[model samples]
Target: MTAVEKLLGETARADAQRNVRRLVAAAREAVAEVGVDVTAHEIARRAGVGIGTFYRRLPSREALLQAVVEDTVYEIVELAREALRDPDPWHGFCTFAAEFVQLRAMSCGINEALGTDCALSLDAPLEQLREQIRLLVERCQQSGAMRDDVPWQDVPFVLTSVMTGDRTIGLTAADDQWRRNLRVVLAGLRAQQLHTSE
Candidate 1:
């Protein structure tokens, strides 16, 4: 191949990479706005790319959703790690839980992608997230900040309860009612008896 041909080939590959990044970013926004059922055309339009380019990069709607899901999960995992580093286990756990639910509520696409069976294999990252959550729960329980009756397995359910999604009856996304619900859940999760220093 001529040097010019090689240079052109490298440039094409670079452009493709950039397009993929743009598509993923745009898909995130589109999913947040339109849920998991967002159309490819809309995502492409948001990305400022042609439909053909979006197809060449993501291949299908599921591919785009998976890309967004992967990005969100990685973000969740990082947040969990940061939470684990906090000095107060109960505060860290509460803050993490609130933030986690809020993040999930922002993207119905993520909930759908996670709950449904897709081609994505995220066992390692998922397991890491689970382990971190377990540690946080255990720490809180040991410190008497959390109720012993509430198992680690129940924590996911507690957090997901606030993710009512667009189906919230008589409540809109702008209501900020989920924050109130989270506060209640956190209060219930805490130990009922007060700890006093004698």
Candidate 2:
């Protein structure tokens, strides 16, 4: 191929990659706003790209949703790994739990997608996230920092449940009431008579 042709090909590939990134980012925000059922046209519009460009990159709504979810799960898994590095197991666990809830709060669509059945192949990253939670829980319990009665399996539910604080009450995001709820839940998770500086 001529040098001019090769250069144009490289430029096209670069643009394609940029478009994919923009689409995924826009899809994330769109899902947060309109939910998982958000249309391709809306996502493309939000991404500032044409519908043809979006189709060329993500093909279908399922593919677009999968990209957004996978991106989020990967980020959560990374946070779990970072939590494992903290010296204080209980503190690390609490931090991880709070951070996890905060991350989930970013998108109601994510919470809905997780609760409902879908075709997304999230088994791998999800399992890894589960394993990390197990390790965190075990570490805290073994240190006599967390309640022995609390099983590792309950961690996810407990964290996610704390997120329901806003909905259960009339409080909106401006109220910041979920932080108080999270603090209470974390306190309840701790072993009795153990003191930790907040």
State candidate 2's TM-score: 0.84
Worst 10-residue lDDT window for candidate 1 reads: 2-11
Report lDDT (Cα) of residue 17, candidate 1: 74
Per-residue accuracy of model 1 over 32-140 as CA lDDT, tens digit each: 7787778889989999999998777655777667556666777787888788889998889988998788887776666655556646655665777788889889999
lDDT of 2 by residue, 119-197 (tens): 6777877888899999999999999998899999987888777665345356464465567778988988898858554
Off by over 4 Å in 1: 1-14, 58-61, 115-120, 165-174, 195-198
TM-score of each: 0.80, 0.84
Clashes of each: 0, 0
Predicted candidate 2: what Cα RMSD to the true structure? 5.8
- At residue 40, give the lDDT of candidate 2: 92
